[model samples]
Target: MNQRNSTQLHPPTRHFSVLLSPTPRGARLARLLATEWLRTWELPHHATEAAEHLVAELAANAATHGRLPGRDFRLALLAGSETLRVEVTDTRGDDLPHRRPATPDGESGRGLLLVEALSDRWGVELGPVPRKTVWAELDLSPEFGNVCSGGSGALLQETREGKKPHQAPPLPPTEPAHSRE
Candidate 1:
């Protein structure tokens, strides 16, 4: 098959990214912007809500725990036909998020738990230097089909109804390593 035909089988992708002050206001704005973008994409209500929650938790975490004076955090949303991936990249590379069981009366430390509950897959990625991206993905194919992906009729369908949730996306591409035989 030609290169164009090979690429056509993949679902169309849409992306939104912004950098904001690492403050409470920024966190709230992250959620609001995400919801608006999803609405523009005509995502289902459940998908939008889940994406909002994931972005809120991630953005709040970045604002609170990942704060570094004079440094801003970035919020990115990658929307595909089958998944919406939310990412908040902060300046704290050493402080990765860890989820622990919270005491019933505890007033804190439950955010990651909510993210875990709402996302099909979630993780953190360390960066070039002094940066870390916390990401979570909500599966959308359960309620909506892939036709909305804005591609030609041909598309990649990830959900199989009874199959398990997809694995987190592979890390950004890297140069291939040559094998020595």
Candidate 2:
């Protein structure tokens, strides 16, 4: 699955995607690679953060739910002027993901909910070869374009300088205390 499904098209100006294996290691590698890629592209921190979460969730789902021996999962990242797209495709067409109601005290379930909240738009694509590509798009605020375009060189240089790519910021703080008036 990590292998290329088809010719990976790298457009001249921007946009790139890579295919990665569907294994747990592959999932981990997807997140790591995405962080580096985003940093190199001078993407805003939020976009990379969302991409990381999406990759982790989708890849975990692929490993735990969509896994088939001898098959591979793929991680694809595409960036445009106003948005960045993250897609994780696995070769599990047998079972599509469903959002189940988690009961009180339930230990698991709720991946798609996070996806819904994080990404501007997301959905699963059933493709030419019975594969499923779950994709999410992160909108790049207008303030980002010039910086990202001009900063790309510096960003790549920073990446080459041995700077470890930064991961997404942690989720917002859970609760606020009530005011004591």
Candidate 3:
């Protein structure tokens, strides 16, 4: 069979999100979970690495500056046609983040710096219950080609013809008990 004529298939990478608690351990888990999830989506090595770094920084910020007693933070990853949006929300509405001068000798204040360098766009959102969400968006179109391990033209054609690609099923809730039940 001619190499050009041989058929190839790759499952679609879909959008998904998750919510985790606001703690140092939670921040670490966020990075690990994001790396695994992105791999399932076929994200390339570079994109996966970038996602891990961004998640770690944002989650750390949430655990440090945005934490409220007994309230947890949330980490969400949303894949789009051309971008991936990473959101980290915490309960401290009063502690809005802003760009400030980092001390030359200080070993702090670099998380936001890293976030700005890695993301295409980022911003903050106010929530319903004195909460705040900080999000960073990363472009995924380029990585998808490498990640899919195939040309995008064919995938586009398939999508144009109204075909749905296979993807991992939604994750079941991690909460152990259902008190209402």
Candidate 4:
């Protein structure tokens, strides 16, 4: 069972949340969905890509380390004028994520290190009961303020009304068009 919701805290803040099964597929889906949403919001290319990676690592950790039978993990994205935050919550409060030195020959145990490197700041938060949310934040560049031409309120309204929010302008064709002879 998957659930999704969107919220507008204020004129400059936007939020999106979804609940997904705690599985490898779910973690992959979280990354894909987050990438699409970030692009829809017209965030800068670098920031969007960075956030995508952050979501992937955090969601993977939740699915792998925080798994509980019949429990779903939650992925939440908060976009503000100056920052973008990615969070993944699971039903394992006692199992908190920590950074450790990864062995050179080990294939695993490097997700948190990647998270720390890619995010401006990252941490874990314990919830009401039997839940924990791991979050990472990226500081947006000044030009990010100019990406949303329609304004955050308008975008939120479109989302609430079930209309597709404005998308970034399409990229130019790689080759120039030829003139008719």
The per-model lDDT (C-alpha) reads: 0.75, 0.65, 0.67, 0.73
lDDT tens readout by residue for model 4, 1-181 = 9987977765578799999989999999999999889999998776798889889989999999999989999999999886788999999998867655678998788887677556655666788699988877765652322332112211122132353423322223432211110
lDDT (Cα, tens digit) per residue for candidate 3, span 1-181: 6566666765444766677778889899889998888888776565566778889999999998998778888888877555667889998877777555689998678777777566545667777668988887655654322332112212221222343333312223431211100
- Among residues 3 or more apart in sequence or in different chains, the pairs in candidate 3 whose N, CA or C atoms overlap within 3 Å are none
lDDT of model 2, residue 72: 83
lDDT of 3 at 67: 80
For 113-136, candidate 2 gives per-residue lDDT tens digits of: 666656655666676577877777
Per-structure clash totals for the candidates: 0, 4, 0, 0
Candidate 4 RMSD to the correct structure: 16.7
TM-score-better candidate, 1 vs 2? 1
Question: If scored against the real structure, what TM-score would every candidate get?
Answer: 0.74, 0.66, 0.67, 0.71
Model 1 Cα displacement at 54 (Å)? 0.7
Model 3 TM: 0.67
lDDT of model 3, residue 17: 68
Worst 10 residues of 4 by lDDT: 149-158
lDDT of 3 at 150: 18
Which residue pairs overlap in candidate 4's backbone? Answer: none
Clashing pairs in 2: 1-72, 2-20, 2-21, 22-73
